[model samples]
Target chain A: MAQKNKLQFIILGLLNQQPLTGYDLTKAFDTEIGEFWQAQHSQIYPQLKRLEEQGYITHEITISGEKLEKKLYHITAIGQTLLGSWISDGTPDLTATKDEFILKLYFIQTNRDPRLKAMVQEQLQLHTDKLTHLQQRLATVFPTKASQTANYGHYLILQHALGREDYYVNWLNQTLSALPKR
Target chain B: MAQKNKLQFIILGLLNQQPLTGYDLTKAFDTEIGEFWQAQHSQIYPQLKRLEEQGYITHEITISGEKLEKKLYHITAIGQTLLGSWISDGTPDLTATKDEFILKLYFIQTNRDPRLKAMVQEQLQLHTDKLTHLQQRLATVFPTKASQTANYGHYLILQHALGREDYYVNWLNQTLSALPKR
Candidate 1:
């Protein structure tokens, strides 16, 4: 199966923590996993529907009285069992896909356009902002719960993001010095 | 447009240098751009077909006597314009989607199984080997042609790959050190 299918298990894993409305799921992903993992509403809503169809989760119509009715989903026992199995089993051995930043840099040497250098600099700034935001968020979440087993996974992800951003900032500085003047 | 669409432009950018078969494109990607960019036969063949339909490339069928026929594609003028515009005006956004390795690590932390740690270690070794092979191939390709203008972009890609591999190795070491004893 395409690793995309693993998103199903990830959703199940999250719902295993608490029953959630679709909006609640989106909020959870943004706060918890969105630092490293992102999903579009287009991808999430369809997956939720499929999971409900497969009996992995059940949804209840929630009448909010103020807005449109919402569907809240809770993981079924089968869903928990499947998620447990997926967690225990190894992940698939798929190669990482191509990254465009590297590709643009590849063409930069040949092209030697000043715009390319600006692009790289822009990316560096964006990453720096994101990394800082993530660090702050992680600190807020982990101050008291730092040693909790559940929070450990998120801690590692934040660490990875921090490391990557530091690397990029250094690289961008070096690249700027090396770039030929327009 | 999905950044995957950019793969076609990358292919066209390379083909602008010389006409090549699908196999040649794959080899170029593996040796030169594989560090930050990757695509399988499943993706390439379909993209090539689409490019042909769009009149951006023309293919010539070569009969190799007893061997299988090869289709060598050459970028047309329209393709060159498209590629040039993509490189010049393309947004250098470095958006990356989900990563399975990180996802698996998240699951592993929850399970805390020794076998899982061992499995991650093994995967890390394989990635290291591949990175080493790619670096060697890049050295061979750019030995005397190092300072060529067009080779600059290629050099940047190699640098990204090396940096990424270093990050992965470091992560593996930290993970191993942090692993709880069985």
Candidate 2:
């Protein structure tokens, strides 16, 4: 895979923490990993099926009346083994594929609408808000936890996100101000 | 587009600086934007074609005897206008996506291989190397030219890339050391 099949590993990693349905997995992604990792139901569902077929996971189909049903996935011993192998063997390249900020900046000079500038400003604010929330969550999750080492790792990633967002907000302000008035 | 066609704009952006052939454009991406942006010819050629079809760029084909030919692209007036609009419009939601380092760390407890630890160490070194290069490039590119303001915008993007890389390196080192020795 051009990208590591980390989605499966992510699912395994989360399930290793606790059992979850596909729906629950999606929610976890949004709540816990949304900032640094993103997945759509489209990508998640297929991977879930693949994991089951490969015997790394087994699913229980729960029927809650005619109108409600869900498949909950639990890791198998083989799944744990596979996930362990991946964790040990997977050398995820640190390289990121694309960034929207640089993309927009590349073409910013082409835009004619003042609203475009405002949109960038809005994005900066959104990122700042997210960074704030991530930091708060980190504090809540790690407060007095014995895993000081893991907490430090989490803090590093959060700090990077925070730093990058701050850079964007600063750049947006300067770029907007420097643009010739429409 | 799910992803903004940044590659197209990147081509237009560089052509705005000066017309360049496909090989030259690839080289520029590697040298100038490699820290924050990347494109293989597989991506660039198709985007160039699309840009030409959209009247954002025009190309001249030059033949260098048998099996050797090149197409040079220059931004059209409309291309310049479009690029400007994209810039002013800011970018699409600057949603940060998956970080491989975090994914690897999350699964690190599963693996027991010494090589896995070594792999993370290698990645830490690579990220450090990249961060150093990005810092040097930023110092060279910014606050020196008449276009220093514009250059600063690009520098901010590069800074984000560097900051994120630094974060990954820190995380990798901490996580690797924290792992139980085999």
Please list all clashing residue pairs in model 2, or write none if there are none.
A107-B87, A108-B87, A109-B84, A110-B83, A110-B84, A110-B85, A111-B84, A111-B85, A116-B89
Q: List the residue pairs that clash in candidate 1.
A: A98-B37, A106-B153
Instruction: Give interface RMSD, every candidate, in order.
Output: 3.0, 4.6
- Can you write out model 2's per-residue Cα lDDT over A1-182, one digit (the tens) per residue? 47567789889888876788988899876776676788888889999999999998988889878958888899999988877777666454555546766655543333444455676676767766766776677677756646434444444455456555665566567656766576
Return the lDDT, model 2, position B105. 57
lDDT of 2 by residue, B1-182 (tens): 68666777778888988889988988977777765677888888888888889899998888888867788788999998987776666444656566676565554333443455676676778778877887787677764645554554465466556666665567667756767677
DockQ of candidates 1 onward, in order?
0.49, 0.33
Best by DockQ: 1
Task: Give the per-residue lDDT of model 1 (tens digit) for B1-182.
Answer: 54357789878977887898888888876656655667777788889999999999999999888888999999999998888777666454546546666765554445365556766677678767766876786667666654545677776666666676777678877867776676
* Model 2, CA-based lDDT: 0.70
